[model samples]
Target: MELFEHLSLGFGVAFTPINLLYCLVGCILGTLIGVLPGIGPVATIAMLLPATYALPPVSALIMLAGIYYGAQYGGSTTAILVNLPGESSSVVTCIDGYQMARKGRAGPALAAAGLGSFFAGCVGTLILAAFAPPLTELAFKFGPAEYFALMTLGLIGAVVLASGSLLKAIAMIVMGLLLGLVGTDVNSGVARFSFDIPELTDGIGFVVIAMGVFGYGEIISNLAQPEHEREVFTAGVSGLFPTKQDFKDMTPAVLRGTFLGSALGILPGGGALLAAFAAYALEKKMKMKPGEVRFGQGNIRGVAAPESANNAGSQTSFIPLLTLGIPPNAVMALMVGAMTIHNIQPGPQVMTSNPELFWGLIASMWIGNAMLVILNLPLIGIWIKLLTVPYRYLFPAIVLFCAIGVYSTNNNTWDVWMVGLFGIIGYSFVKLGCEPAPLLLGFILGPMMEENLRRALLLSRGDWSVFVTRPLSAGLLAAAVLMIIIVMLPAVKNKREEAFVEE
Candidate 1:
């Protein structure tokens, strides 16, 4: 079969010695960072983006993929141990996961998380393998009009699905789109919002925004918290995994989460955070075994559902990036940057032109998932020790490294200073309860939207009807409008916000 042949090629590439080593390194590093509260994969990957320039394309992607999913694996540990989420997706896990730890069921809770994640990751990957080809085919049919319409849908999805105030999310996205317009116009060769700064002529660097907003923003937020590091749990955490009955209770939750997460992960703005929260909420709404643990108090279903959903979501989030060259989340946006660094375009042609890199990256995810399971369980002790380190010492070193990384991106101190200014903006977003992920999605998509819209108009000789005349493009635009309307309904808006709440 075509799929089998592709897998053979993928494994051959992913199994190379160098690729395997990087995979191991990435998994280990991701686990380490993911165990530390307040640091997520976006910042970590952004920190390491420069380092990947030295790596072969396959190896670079293999390692970054490991970090992305490995964080999912390591995140549950902190959620269970310290009542903190290392990744945003793990936030829902903390509700019941920490309760399990408190009730002396940490071992079982962790086992459920690990096992559920591994299973769901495999299913998500399988779904990706089966569906990506068709999606890629569909993508090839798109024109400039269709692309603009699809991007409209994506931006709307980001606005509707983001977890804070809808107004704030919209504002953030509009800001990102506006900021995306700060560079020189392609057709006119005139600067729009460059403010006469040389660096602004090329637009703001995605790396700087990512590092400043995700990295430095997180540092400031963490520093603002009081110096109160919780002691790591040692007892009830070292032994006693799930029993037969526990497995019986967990199997259904894992299945539900995998299906739910796989479907949601393909949608714009529906990444691990949304999937996890949705799955956890759905589990609570469904009927449970009469004698089982209650919803927020050491429920294995709680651990399994969110953990599985997050991993599934993390894997399936790649569909948009790989198929359409559109990034569905901040992490996928980072992956787009990675692909561009290697001079590989992140679209349908990638599969036809570079099958090895594409398939190998897919295969590497399964390998990374396996590696995460092996690395996370045995290295739990080391990860726990990392959490014990004080923020006072940890944050300064982080800020210093981030500064160095941003400056190293273009070898310009101006970029570093710009990152500092963005850091303030990032912190302001946090204090105002605004989510930055949608802003990131908007920033990444804005330029692409403008280019396509311009192209569509040019092709149509300035005819505005071109967007509505094409059936496919019109359908997509209609869906975008429908989505916005659905989300704006009072009941749906309430439920949407409520579903994304951690607890």
Candidate 2:
């Protein structure tokens, strides 16, 4: 009865004419964003943050949420058609999705991604709705010590699960933490690393870093590639439906990926990027059929699992943000900024104080997922045509768009300049074969961790034992330590390193 009433309220809020229109617009924009090369949702959301200033808080969030998942749906399209991933999460899809395209099975691959994503998204939202209350209840018991411990767990999980060398991942995390400390010291009012720059007083904008590393960085990388490499796979796509064998393979894979992605999404620092890689790795590890296609060779399960997992992970990543006031990844960090712009603190109180916003956001996801399925299937022809645009023509517009977006944030060219500087750094990382996602996660979470650590020590009268003495905090620390040890094991380390290597 309670669940039904809550859902009814949600539908009432989500079904408003204005909200529905914005949701539709967001879906279309997100699909366009995803179909293009060298653009991802993190950069897109950050670029569009200013546009939301005119929208109602609920409607603004609905649009952003739609954009997030809609990008996931469309990302697979680019991956399948061009072997280019519009989002990091779509990177895995290229392994088999592009191969399927080359074989004229592009239709099945796109259908699998769209359908699997819809199912996973539905299930993910259901889990978020059902599980958030209990998690909120659990969160109410959190003190400073527990919060610190929780962040530690999150950082550790990121390091353990991050792609590439473990040492490099840890170094990136440390670098992010340092970057996060470059503003005013909330405790002492002393600027830590501003070096006397006025804008540094407010700290660097999360959007600035995201645009630099993901947006401009991607632009630079794409320019470095040969023109031939940028050409779209000009393969014919027929048969807009999956065959019976595809169903047999994709059903189990989608279900498994959904469950895996949902569970990972609840973990701090775990988001769609991680979920997609982990799901593909899991599928590869599972016993292959006697004569079916292998992974990295057009296996349908490879397309379905990562698509489902990434969508599930994308939705569940909202769990920590909505319930605990924690952002799991760069995109969620942007969401925190969005919530604050509306004078809303993103925490447990959101449910009780703004029940309509909370439930409406939940309901809007279901609507958005359905909207994506409808919009994507019929419009497949249009999306593929977009790939025909050449990279030389596309990159300039993207660079110009990013410049305008960054300048709009503060009406200053400084952020634009910063984007260029970070673009170089991002390119360095790319050249060095390093992953940047974990660094962004660390940058977002670091300050929160420091604040909690100080508060916990203050309460403990500077005693460090409080983290270990409190039962919940102690348990969290224990789990983090166990994770570190497991990650350090030679066999596990080698396997994780191999698992993330793109084919």
* lDDT of model 1 at position 331: 92
> Candidate 2 lDDT, tens digit per residue, 1-503?
77778888998999999889888988888888878876778767866777787799999999999888777777789888889888888999999999998888989999999999999999999999988878888888999999889888888877777767788878888988989999999899998899999888888877788888877887898789998777575545689899999999899999999999988877666467778998998998888888899788899999999999989998998999899888887788888888988899888889889999999999999999999999998888888888888877987888888888888878989899998898899888889877787788788888889999999999999999999999999999999999999888999878877877898
Q: Give the distance in Å from residue 343's predicted Cα in candidate 1 to where it truly belongs.
A: 1.0
Give the TM-score (vs. native) of candidate 1.
Answer: 0.97
TM-score of 2: 0.96
Estimate TM-scores for all models: 0.97, 0.96
Candidate 1 segments exceeding 4 Å error: 229-236
C-alpha displacement of 276 in model 1, angstroms? 0.9
Clash count (model 1, backbone only): 0
> lDDT at 59 for candidate 2?
96
What are the RMSD figures for all models against the true structure? 1.4, 1.8
- What's the CA error at residue 372 for candidate 1, in Å? 0.4
